[model samples]
Every structure is written in structure tokens, then in C-alpha cells.
Target: MPAGVRVTLRTDSSSLVCRYQADPAPTLNGPGERARIDVVCDGRRADTVKLETHGGDAGFRCEGLPGRMAAPGH
Candidate 1:
């Protein structure tokens, strides 16, 4: 995927989860790092996700609830 690329999905689900991997990341940390990933539903803030990264090379997950995404002008 290129930078600034937007993706959309159309569905009728009350909740959804997105998971992805970042190759060549950092190692797993002992205490880990604290971060928050926001979930947007219908162009609005729907939920906030708590993330703990053990290392640079790790998996990032994002989730949303009761949201729908489709290609623009669809």
C-alpha cells in the first residue's frame, strides 16, 4: 500500500477488528510501550484501543464497532 492511500469496506457488522504486521520492526520490550489506536465509525470517533508494543517488529491491531466503509461516492 502507498502512503495516503485510503481503503473502505462495506458491511453491516456491529463490531470489527483490523490486524496488520510491520516488517523489520523493533524487538520486543520487557515493559513494552503504551499507545492508543482510535477507531472511526462513519467518519467519527467510535472507540479507543489500547496497545502495548514489546518490540519494533510487531503486529498492530485496530478495531471499530458499528461502522461501515465504502469507496468514495459509492
Candidate 2:
């Protein structure tokens, strides 16, 4: 299998909320193929989201809201 692509997202202390939407069109083949997605916030590791290349073409909704501080001095 070929190596997947990497996508980077950055956020700040003031701006903690974020949202993303995927295109509602299929552009690949196979049912077992996978698409890897990574989301980072405030220069720290935040969340890693993944989706399977199945169920036909469909749009996706991703959101990142403010949560508990990762560090104490936040």
C-alpha cells in the first residue's frame, strides 16, 4: 500500500474552536482503503481522526472545541 498524506492544522489559545468539512464526492477506489486525518491545536498534539473509504461518497463534519488544558500553565 502507498503511504498516506499528512495534513496539519494549527490553533491558538484564543481561538480554540475549529471545524472542517470534507467533499461529498468519491475520488478513490477499493472498499478497504483508508484516509488518515490529523488535527493539532496550540502547537500540541490534539486529535487524530480517521475515516474508511467506504459507504460511497459522503461529506464529513469535524469539529474541535475548547477543552481541558493539556498543560497546567495554559
Candidate 3:
């Protein structure tokens, strides 16, 4: 992944799971510093996700998300 890259997904469930495989060589920051990912919901900032910098296959889980609700009318 490069700078200014964005990944988006849509789900109806109130929970989300994100997984990624990364190598430590490409990381400019050290293990002590972690990247912060901004999670956007409906074009608005909903939450901030802090990534684990240890590298390799790892993921994060988010619960209690404000999922989309059915409107009054179809």
C-alpha cells in the first residue's frame, strides 16, 4: 500500500473485521510507532483504528458499529 490510499467496505452488520498481511521492511516507522487508520461511516469520521506494527498476518475487530438502519419507507 502507498500513501493516500483508501480502502472501503460496506456491511449491514454492526460488527466488522479487517485483516491484512504486511512486511516490516517497507515500514518507515519503528515498532514503537503505530499507524492510525480513520474509519469513515457515511462519509463521516466514525472511529480511529490503531494498527499493530509487529508485521505479518494480523487483524483488528470492531464491534458496536452504527450500521445502516431501514428507513420509514422503502
Identify the leading candidate in terms of TM-score.
3
Query: Ten consecutive residues with minimal summed lDDT in candidate 1?
Result: 51-60
Q: Write the per-residue lDDT of candidate 2 for residues 1-74, one digit (tens) a residue.
A: 22565554333343333334445534447775555445555455456555544444332334563543444332
The residue ranges of model 3 lying beyond 4 angstroms of the native Cα positions read 24-26, 69-74
Error of 1 at 31 (Å): 8.5
Q: State the local distance difference test value for candidate 1.
A: 0.53
Model 2 segments beyond 4 Å from truth? 1-33, 52-64, 67-74
Which digits, one per residue and each the tens of the lDDT, describe model 1 over residues 1-74? Answer: 12343556566676655555555443445676444556555676667665444444333445455544544555
The worst-scoring run of ten residues by lDDT in candidate 2 lies at: 10-19
Candidate no. 2 TM-score? 0.34
Model 2, residue 40: displacement in angstroms?
A: 0.4
Backbone clash pairs for candidate 3 read: none
Model 3 lDDT at residue 66: 78
Query: Quick one: ranking by TM-score, best first?
Result: 3, 1, 2
Candidate 1: list runs displaced more than 4 Å.
1-7, 26-32, 52-64, 67-74
Q: How far out, in Å, is residue 60 in model 3?
A: 2.2
| TM-score of every candidate | 0.46, 0.34, 0.67
Mind giving the per-residue lDDT tens digits that candidate 3 earns over 1-74? 35676886766678777878776433545566556677666666777876654447655666767777533331
